[model samples]
Target: MSRKTLIPIGPYHPLQEEPELFKLYCDGEIVTDIKWETGYNHRGIEKLSESKSYDQVFFLVERICGICSTSHPFAFANAVEEIVAVEITDRAKYIRSIIGELERIHSHLLWVGLAGHFLGYNTVFMWAWKYREPVLDLFEMITGNRNSYAMFKVGGVRRDIENSKIPAIRKEIAVIRKKIDLLTGAVMDDPVIHARTKGVGILTRQDIIDYGAVGPTARASGVDIDVRRDDPYAAYPLVNWKVITAQAGDVFAKAEVRLLEMYESASIIEQCIDALEKMKEGDITLKINEIPEGLGTGRAEAPRGEVFHFVVSDGSNSPARHKIRAPSYTNIATFKKSCIGQTIADATLSLAAVDPCYCCTERMAAAYDNSSGKKILNANELIALSLKRTSELRKSGTGHE
Candidate 1:
């Protein structure tokens, strides 16, 4: 008989979220069922935003998640704009896009590196972090803060991209793009990664629709949905770019989608820079003192997924009600479908394939052998086991081996 064992991931640890607990039901080597517990680190940013005025809300929402710092503010800004029916300046539009894309680059690199780490790939961890520094440097140069970039406001962007810096920024992006291509090839084309990730954690297209999954999680399942394209915002309409999707709906598919998307993000920023170069470095924002009595909803295609913000105003400076929905909220649910039927060795990477933030921030895992009541593997050790499984499967020329 296959004994039922519960693998507890974390309650205060990081895997895809800030702090969440997951209990995976395993029957020997195969994960039979999974249930998760969350809400470990809730700062109540939504409730706090109600007390702050529209202008002040930007700073508060940016702290929702350090990785998604811009995403929150970007969505909040859009919600505010919708309520007042305010149209921002053209320069501000492109600036917002540039900043948003830069955020995407850094956030994706963080995920790729961390995912690599969870798979026993230290070189990927080092190189990914190394290349990510320039993106932060660019953010620091533009927004004065690398992580909590307080660039997006209700009316427009807070800062303008200097015309003189365009040449340098493009140079940096070109170099980084080349490195990303190399890294992407290393992971995507490699047979071992395929052996480890392919056909694992398969989330069908219907599963995505059922769970309301977004971003790479859904895109990896071959779902054609992106807030940037389906619902155009900022400079997305002006720039030419394609949304990347994969049919396999496995860990490798998720990796391919993200890796390919980075190139598109870089290209979007390049296009934005070109647009910025032609225009004068004019007003970045148009300040609004009051918000009218209306409900506003806005969404931005965040790095991990879609960041949706809802604001209720009663002609007051502060919001009457503030609701924030990070992609992690929806993306986490899909794990129920993806995790089951996967081996204990594949559970860690399967969870990682979704890349949760607000839901997935750090990697944490625990493997318990139910029959003997012995906790067996740590997160990295699980990766080692997965790697070993890969080796065995590759060497024997059969999965049964």
Candidate 2:
């Protein structure tokens, strides 16, 4: 007799607010097949961009994700500036690079905390978040905002780092570096962390390339593809740093890749600070007489992965067509392939291992109870029931999510 089981993961879970359904077909304790359903949060932002001007689109793209808000604007500005042939000042470029690195640091820390929370490690979650506060404070100190640091403008950045703030900025970075070192030790030395994550959700080198993975996901699988090095944008080429990579291709490897990347980002920030000190002041932005009809493409290394923005202008204030390729889109696609043959217990961690940004991925939908007239289960209740089913399926060692 052939036995089969079905398991549904979530449309809403504490770990992820985005609605994605994972259907796992299994026999006994092994997952036989996996299927994924997305498009729950399709906000039509890309289509909406067509109605907005290049300047206005910057703000629109910033709403793509709360975590990498600055990166979106930075990439969009670069694309627009390229179309107009605007040459931004060296000082502005260094400033942009510095803030970008700082964003990367905080983004990675945030991901680390989320990863801890998914694994039920509340202590690590709290500690990582507490440490992340300093980085946000540094951002608020510089740009006057904690989340949306609207520093980047059309021709150049909106504001420049003043001489008076130099010493304080340097001191803040020193403290951040110390915190990173301490966190690194805890991540590497923690026995529970390794037990739950080290060998879980292995994505081999070939699998990574076949699935078209990017950012830290691809890097963890030993793929040396970084837009910063491959396409040398902004001041990335001018600064010195190594592209961090790992050969393990597991959840632990991905975490290690991000952890080590913090050090590299710190070094890049230090380099930018030094470059800023030597840079001379000049016009931050160039005067654009007119915007001609042109198509421009801009790609940046977002904290999650690679972010691509394609803009086509028809000599009008608004773009004729604007397309945004978020990293989460591609990263989420790989979950179907990665989840097969794994236990349900590994489902949450594995899905989360890719460092998903559901807020960027899914659109909000009304939570409804589909149980019946007798009882209506909320979204959270449904998710909890699914978890219970997944546990039952895994008890036989033949389930996946």
Candidate 3:
């Protein structure tokens, strides 16, 4: 007879940054129940944003999620722009898109590497991370920081994509594009990986609709929605690109959508660069005075999904109320639908499928046994248990025990 046991992941695991705690209940090898807790870091960023001026909030929001550093600020900037009622220059628009696309490339590649690590595929992890370096290098060259690129401003972008650097950047993007194609081919062609990922954590299209899942998580489930395509902002409206989707709604489908989206991201960057050449250079930013009294809202397609920001201004430098909603908010909720009947092995990957900001998830989390109300395994033990499941699957040639 199988007995129910609880496994907890997070509140400061070595591999995680967000400090989340997941309570997974298992009977033998199958997951019978699941629960999640978040909000460990709780820096009060929204309330903190209320203290800062419109210009200062850009830097503040960038710190919300290191992985999603640009996305938050990007959305916040859009909100501020809406408040002021101004359009950025054509050059500024292209510059914004360039940075955004670069961020997406690096982010998706990093996710690929992490997913590989979870499956005990170190080679895939290495190759994916290797391709991600050039993207960070490009960020450093353009915005002075690899992690928090402080280029987003209220009126427009703070940095200009120079003509001299365009050739070098384009060459790097082309190189990265080639590597991405190779990686995508390798992942899709591998059979063992398919067994581990395909149909493992299936979130039905109905689950996505009910939970409001976004980004690749929703796209993988065949729900076609992208902020860039549906509601265009920055240079997204000007560029030629397509939103990628997959119908599987499993971990593999999530991976496929992200990998395919990389090509689109690279192409968008290329188009933006070409457009920049035709537009006036050094006109990347606009001048704006005091903010008016009104509500301003903005949304941007982050690497994970949609990043939304709502700001209310009352003729002051600081926002009267600032609300930020990361894609993972609704995305994480879908776990209740995807993880309930999965094996313990698939639970971690399913959560990772959302490409959540570890710190963001950890910012608010707690874990305990549902049966007895006692604290169970911590983050490291939970990870070990999940990895052990993969190891067993690899040796047995069957994912379920």
Model 1 CA lDDT for position 228: 95
Clashes of 3: 15
Best by lDDT: 3
Better of 1 and 2 by lDDT: 1
Q: Which model scores highest in TM-score?
A: 3
RMSD of 1: 13.5
Backbone clashes in each candidate structure, one number apiece?
11, 7, 15
Ranked by lDDT, the better of candidates 2 and 3 is: 3
Deviation in Å, model 3, residue 136 alpha carbon? 0.7
lDDT of 2 at 89: 76
Off by over 4 Å in 1: 13-17, 359-401
Q: Which parts of model 2 have CA positions greater than 4 angstroms off? A: 1-3, 25-30, 362-401
| Each model's lDDT | 0.85, 0.81, 0.85
Give per-residue CA lDDT, model 2, range 1-401, as digits (tens).
86988877776644565666777777776677777666576565765677566667777788878898977887787777778877777788888888888999999998888889888998778988999999999999889999888788777888778756778888988999999999999988999999999888898888888888899999998999888889777789898999999999889999999999999998998888787777665545566666778988878888888888777878988778777777887787777667777777676688888987765665423344566544455556755765686689779887532
Q: Give candidate 2's whole-model lDDT.
A: 0.81
Lowest lDDT sum, 10 consecutive residues, model 1, at: 358-367
lDDT of 3: 0.85
In candidate 1 the C-alpha lDDT for residue 15 amounts to: 48
